[model samples]
Target chain A: MEKKRNMQSKELICTACPIGCRLTVFQDEKSENWFRVEGNSCKRGINYAIAEMTDPRRILTSTVKVTNSHYKRLPVRTREAIPKHLIFSCMNEINRIEVITPVRMGDILIDNIASSGIPLIASRNLE
Target chain B: MLNYELVVIGGGPAGLAAAIEARKNGVQNILVLERDLELGGILQQCIHNGFGLHIFKEELTGPEYAQRFINELLEMDIEYKTDTMVLDISEIKTITAVNKQDGLIQISANAIILAMGCRERTRGAIRIPGTRPAGVFTAGTAQRFINIEGYMVGRRIVILGSGDIGLIMARRLTLEGAKVLAVAELMPYSSGLTRNIVQCLHDYDIPLLLSHTVTDIRGKDRVTGVTISKVDQNLKPIPGSEKEYQCDTLLLSVGLIPENELSLQANIKLDPRTGGPIVNESMETSVEGIFACGNVVHVHDLVDYVTEEAQKAGAGAADYIFEEITEKIPAVPIVPQEGVNYIIPQNIRIDNLNGFLDLMLRVTSVYRNAKICVRADEKTIKEVKRPHLSPGEMERVRLNSNIMKTIRPKTISLYIDGEKTQYAI
Candidate 1:
């Protein structure tokens, strides 16, 4: 006699670094932890796989309009990774703002962008 | 004619780092000549992160990484001229350049470093059969327009080739409310980093069509659509496997070529395999007192590696200026054997080597469970086991001075032994 088991699996490619590791996430219904990650080359991939299976996030980078600078746009990025689903909405908010010149690199252009609590900072100095 | 101890051409990451290193090595009066209005070169338009991981131990955007070098260079008080283009370089180290501020200026330098970097391959280079259209743009050009110029290229996009630039643009355009239909790569496996494939394409649900290429571009004044076809084993398009994607923009990211026009003017030797200058262990070119590094020597995958190589070139230039590199014997040749595409520092003067030597190479194809064997005569000097090897990623192996004592003064060879695998996406 055999017992029936509830098992779910998902395949993912870890994007923690350039050496993208293929990861397999398995969910065991009977286990207390429920999720187990396999095929990771390092410990970082384990967290990446689990986060991917749960709530995915990404560091959103884009350009914001600038004034009084030699260049027309200033490159900006989120201070931290935000929820993946908020990328477009973040962009929409970023596009609405125009920065002034003499903005230093790492200057906060937008605070709590898109209500994600991640500030958008300038990627370069615009003199 | 103005004179300097060292003259670095192209004030990008390579030139900046090289100049800084030379100054640090006690060689003063260094000057960097840049053709652009600013110092950062192509990095100014690369607004994305994932740079400086190895060097800084933290991820940074491209401009931020370049700025760190630029700030250091400025702090060192190294003189540099922006918007100055070097027109020619004589074998005797005379640099002729022109700029708005200093028109037709000539500088006599004791040592010169070439760091002119590379340029992207255009549509004509790949020869896509199509009528002349306005919507086609190279991936780098599109990146510059969108990121720097603050202009939208198109609302609908179809990118060809899976190189990192192409992959990044697919995400960039999509974030700006553009529809990225597909990314078609002629090769079965992407030539880009694996992380880029996952983040730029998979995350966005943009289909990456492997072994596929754009056969035709359809539009008169603007690109209305494109026809993509699956390629066969021979890399030829299959007869019946054709799909049409109606996109207004077609972005090409085929490849990048080293910018070595000035190297040719100076009659420096170039390697056809790497499409860059043939350098020694010291990063010195065939022309004495002339050193080259970074993308001008060979296209590098990482900016951190570029900085490291440029520092070597800078140190080499300083040593040449001070006459510190004493050649005790004729240089020995390095040979690339089966499964190896090419090796940098094509020749080395073993007597001038320090405690160790680092050799960088790329495999001819993808391999599984591979062993990279370095041989001096018949004996194996060093062997490293790699679980996986791909042409997309460069490999580096270090040789210690202890291994140099066993050499027979013959040619050194490097090759891979493993099960060759055709990379499939």
Candidate 2:
């Protein structure tokens, strides 16, 4: 059996302001994942390529139950980054978790959900 | 100083719309001062298609849409000054401007408008530690050079910020024979529209780097390379992952800041988030007789939205001629609640209610299959279901004024409801 050396990966673009860099990642066949990145022109591209290849993380967007506020529950995101492969898994755990307020911005509703360092938190304060 | 009924600064979409509306309302004396050699504002440089979808029902280029308003202004025979730069505006509606041949001239009006639009956030604002090179330019500036001036920015290019302009420029440069290295973004998602992602980056096989930020720039007189690093939750650069890309040109499309120097000088209160004046329902600012619209209020992703907002502002200025629409203290102030980033129209006026109230907002992150719930004082006022939601695109939620008038909350809050972020509304 032959061992694969170099691996290829695709990237998703999200500058949020307009410079969309959809980068393509290629990992070297040798050890250390001695990676060589192509496409991006800035330091941002280099970093994104490396992370996408190594530990891909994402911010989970969901909602928590907030009582005693203007209305009902409010939308929120995890303050911490979820592992690249565990995004959907953490989202599942987040879906199951809900909190009641008075919740403030950056309030942690759930800590280390599913053993991932990601914390389901409030993006805005709810009184 | 010459006195007039209204003086519109900048001959962009907002200014032209305001001028025409003022004239329609029977404001006899009107003056539109333009800083450029011609009347058209930034629209002249944006030659790409995707404009006038809402207004004309067809995708026209930026210039054509601007020309429509320009032609209408000419038809009305409104008094306008081209190559005129309005330097200052005092509290008394006095304007001072200068031109190469015209020298200095001062004019006064019963009402004045600031429609100066916005400027692109550059490398300095982002503080991308790098050598001061000549090759670096903003995405818009690069577009102007390549599209209108017919100058290739670089043989090899790297763009920062996955903005609409940056993405479009990537494709544009590819067509013109420039090798776009990649488009880098600090966030994990693309900020631009999904359509642009497919057409601009995907189609060209151009890579979009997400959750990444440029940490350093390399080169002396001109750009040679840059050191980039991965960002954590706080967007701080990660250590031991520094990598470099060799390129001649670096374009920054990081963001846009509303051109509000004059607004600030005029003492108009500004929203720190949008970088535009804190405007109410009528597009009237804190300062009396001073109004604003278009990109001068906030960076708009779509030009049609600018027209829609500007038209209202223009009409509002005209209405001021016949009626004194004094703003009453807003009963409810719209603020971000949860998972929400920010909302526009910082203040909401209920008196003399308009047909509908539109609230412009952006999310802090990405989500799918969600319902946006707008609340007033702990009671659900409005909720709308959406299939896909992302922070890249700005969301406009139009509330029924009649319905809004009935339910007034001291603080209007917005949140998401669905399987992931389900909440009781």
Candidate 3:
């Protein structure tokens, strides 16, 4: 068996707290999981690193055009974090839609947007 | 004239929290007057997350955190007025307000809580020398355009002053496909939180130039570019270090000043440092029965702390409404000596002794391996070690009623101990 010559390592800053410890995640050649994290002050950093390496997510916030309301636009957000890859596409879909008046806070604008199983909910009331 | 037990001016997060607490504390007839179309104030435009960490123990977006309080306030059947603007507030607890439906309404309230939040300082306040340009917007104005109005302010941006709003906007404008050239801060260290510096700037490869100032702005109609230069120790521009960046928009996040014109009209003594009404341990200003809290008291780093402070003000207002003149408790003034910037509740009232009171303060500068020393009448009452302290973060110290009882009505000072003065060369 030939030995592996290179292992990839990535550096990230943990956004868990104000300390913002610089975290480094490296691919372990011998381990099956292929990832080991270091330089984190707490367990949250390790979890954040592993998730970042495997799959990343972000809470999307944007505005939707509204008609028949005092305000011209309505603020909306993903009820839960969605996959990072779908952010722009989700924004595109959200940009294409226009909501009517009498919207309440927490009203779902789109169900399972971008097939992410997260609904885009209204962030404020526009009556 | 309409009479109520309490009238809260401004229905932002602070006003909502204060009204809810006051209603819960037996002030049945309470009204919250909000000038906006809805209850939530600036939180509506702040679409990003990282709020409500301390109060809810979970990361929430601005609107979500605000809705939690709004739901609670509504569920309790508390009265509130949206789209109402308070014109004048008299020292005798009289409030005059106006709206479309309730035109020129007057109310004689037993107590009043001023929860009017802060406003962002504009370019005119800082006097950034430039031609009248359309692309120059405050960071919050840009945020409102992109986050709430669904309109992009510009394609290219340069943010001045690395406050939390500026840092967040750097990431927000980037996510919206705008090119952010750099963020210039006048101070040697950023006033924004450290986590924001990492996620907002470093993660996005945006440069944060500390000890930098925007010397001149270039543009006639829309912003064409800006000239930024390094500042000397005295914060004056260093001529040789000037550099230019081509950008369409220039965003200013210089500072926030408490909206206190109504407070001044009420003749409430203002704190020169905080730009807010000065209050004692009860959150009551020099004017009796009138309480103040939230950003109107002083700019806060977190909204949760605003809610907490509002609750204290709410409770204090309710106590004044319910209790009679049984006794007068002598209070002592809290003097900020070395390292302490300013302390809220400028005086510690010793009467109606609560179990504990929290003293909120901010340091003048950054320090390492330091302990905060609290003294009363020239005697050390308490000492607490803080591993790291910065001007950007607020420091809170809890004073037990027992410890406060031991001290007499004299001078109380808070200073830093064991502060490292110099770095090894």
C-alpha TM-scores of all predictions: 0.96, 0.74, 0.92
Which tens-of-lDDT digit does each residue in A1-127 have in candidate 1?
Answer: 0011334787788777545667778886665456787888888988887788778888889999988888999999999999998998999999999998998899998999999999999999888
lDDT of 1 by residue, B1-425 (tens): 99999999999999999999999999989999999989988888888888999899988998999899999999999999998999999999999999998789999999999999999999999999988889999999999999999899999999999999999999999888899999999998998988788888888889888899999999999999999999998999998998899989999999999999999999999999999999998899999889999999888888898999999999888888888896445777888998999998898888677777888899989888899999887777788998789888888888885567556457889999999986734
Residue runs of model 3 more than 4 Å from their true location after superposition: A1-8, A24-39, B324-328, B418-425
Local accuracy of candidate 3 as per-residue lDDT tens digits, B140-235: 988888876668999889999999999999988887789999999998888898768876787578998989999889988888999999999899
Better of 1 and 3 by DockQ: 1
Global Cα lDDT for candidate 2 = 0.74
In TM-score terms, which candidate is top? 1
TM-score of chain A of 1: 0.81
Per-residue lDDT, model 2, residue A54, is 72
The superposed Cα distance between candidate 2 and the true structure at residue A15, in angstroms, equals 18
Q: List DockQ, one per candidate, in order.
A: 0.48, 0.01, 0.32
Q: In candidate 2, what are the lDDT values of residues B164-200, reduced to their tens digit?
A: 8888888767755679988988877667776577656
Q: What's the lDDT for residue B139 in model 1?
A: 97
Q: Give the best candidate by DockQ.
A: 1
